[model samples]
Target chain A: MTARSLDWESGQGERKWRRRSLWALLLLVPLALAGQAYDSVKTLLGGEDLFPRQVAWGQSAHFGGSDWKLTDLRGAFGMSSLPPDSVPVLADFSVKVGDPDLQKLWLGCKVMLIDAEGRRWSPTSAVSLKAPGDVHTCVSAIFSGARRGDTLNLRETFLVPRQATKTIRPAVGLASERPHFLFFQLEKD
Target chain B: MMRKMANVILLLLATALCYGLQVSKPHYAELIGPIPAYGKLGDAVVGRGFEARAAKVAFSRNLKVDRYGQTKVFTTGGIWAVVTVEFAASAQSTTVAVASWRGPTGLAYDQTERLSFADGLLPVAIDPGLPKKARLIFEVRPDEVSNATLLISEKLMSALDSQAEISLGPVAAGADGLPAETVDTLDLTQPI
Candidate 1:
């Protein structure tokens, strides 16, 4: 076989196949670009993880009189005057950036619960912002109540001014001298 | 080669778009925590009701020390939280075995016997058979906020008073068997 003629005859088909495959990939490039552009625009214009669900779990505390100075940390709930079961015991938090200024704000609580059987449930999608001084509302969903020693910790991104009070009731018996619910706050830390 | 370069560019663009499109922001909310809980003082400290609702709950009675501040919670039905006393007080001792009453109609002491203390607060555990919201009268004596220092803030007595009612605080023995600090019932209100 003549070298040049034989090589050409064998590889002619391979060259055609390579060229076809490369062209196909090049065509796909623009489609991917377009999809990405659409996604970015949507996100920047108020469209990202719009809502987040939180799961409540156990919490513990230790003390020796250490002070804490803090920010972006909410305060405890202590509205004892309310009727029993008027409010939720555990809640998580979400963030919302607002219009023009994109003023940072909190949306609504993500009600959290863990059943006696150790099953966990947190259902949150979207929470509407409130009209007053950048406040939002979250309602409690009835679930099996929490047991003694069980705990709920809400999200820690909201700012609570000093000594704010929140009302809550216990599902179980509570000792009058020993509080059923306890709150740990950011002091001079 | 040109086709290969174009393919690479496509993948990068797709990745960036996906990242940008997911535009949710998280706003931080602050929550306070570890409120104090007092316990283990003996049988004298227990909750109210057949269900023992106050068995483990702790409540703070707001008393005015000469009118510094006052907080009163009274109801006719349902249940009101009250502090329970576990033992008789010693004339020299200042600590009373204190607790809460569940299903309480008013702020009465826990045990059957009512031994007055130096503290103005009189905790009364309501008899369950009675009305849920008792007719309560909160009388702030002139001694309220007596220990509060305006210059140096945060004293311990007010802090305790802010939580559980003070039971056996600062007493001297009197010939009448009542602690010197104990206020006359006539001066204080009823169902305290």
Candidate 2:
């Protein structure tokens, strides 16, 4: 072949290789970003309440390596001690232990009421209500040290707007199970 | 050859611009730092979660705190700067947990830990619709007391959260070069 023809072929080959490398680099950019953001994305998804595992009221479901049944969602309104236009709500649950390692699995336990408008009300200490001695809060239950198959009653109190009491649903979130949490449907609604 | 020289100069300018941009960029911590809500001493500074108003400021050499019928006197090497602030939660029940006294020289003095057992200290729970008065005590140099700013927030690491910054105005100096309002002792047992 002629020298000019050989030079043209070699140049074409080099251009093709450069094009392929450019495409590979375009693909590597996202891969590098994903690698750098893997931990942050995982933490954002796993540490927040993004997804809900729905359970019918009065039915038991397994969550966070334990069997949980939401027993009641009641509201007390117009209490002399509570603030005006607010209602104090109580969410009761009975959880049966399976793993019995609550300190690890149930760390940062939260039981709150979420409304249809996406507003959430965390448990408040403003409402002073009497409960049975065996009933413990989600935080207190973690340190209760119950054995396997032992059932513990948990209670949480939230002070929310009176209008929110109608549309609110009780939810339970454990550090190990988030962004997947147990959302219970109210029987009255 | 002239075009090539122009291209080189353009590239050098671009590099210098990039370097300047990088050098002038804020630090990562400052980029995500607290959003400030500024106000004067008597003005109510409303943040996203709470509202704070600095009603008064006092200087003292000793603090007498009474708890459980026992009076304990706490002395400070420097002067004690006491700022009486009224805080109210806006939407929910929250705690005003952190406060600092920032001097004119940009030095920040955190609320004194010596008054942790004193009643009405910070980290006090504020309820919605109810305003509560609390004291922020800081042991700072006598010279740094003037032109001080009081900063209050919900927590210590309040990134991207609202922080109240109240300018205390200038303090008067006495004949001895100390704050003119400095008292020998201040009793914390009195209701704020």
Worst 10 residues of 1 chain B by lDDT: B145-154
lDDT for position A54 in model 1: 23
lDDT of 2 by residue, B67-135 (tens): 678998889888999999999777655789999999999999999887788888988776555567899
DockQ of each: 0.01, 0.15
Which has the greatest TM-score? 2
Instruction: Write candidate 2's Cα lDDT for A120-180 as tens digits.
Output: 6778876889999999999999999899999999999888877777798998888899889
| Tens digits of lDDT, candidate 1, B1-192 | 999999999999998887776554332221121123233322222211111111221112332222223433222111122222222211111222233231112333232222233232323222111112211222222232122111100122323221222222222434543324433223223432
Best by lDDT: 2
Candidate 1 lDDT score at position A128: 24
Q: lDDT per residue, candidate 1, A112-156, as tens digits?
A: 222232222232121122223323322221121322232222232
Off by over 4 Å in 2: A23-26, A74-89, A115-119, A124-131, A158-169, B1-37, B42-64, B72-78, B86-95, B125-133, B159-162, B173-187, B190-192
Q: How far off is residue A150 in model 2, in Å?
A: 2.3
What value of lDDT does candidate 2 attain over all alpha carbons?
0.89
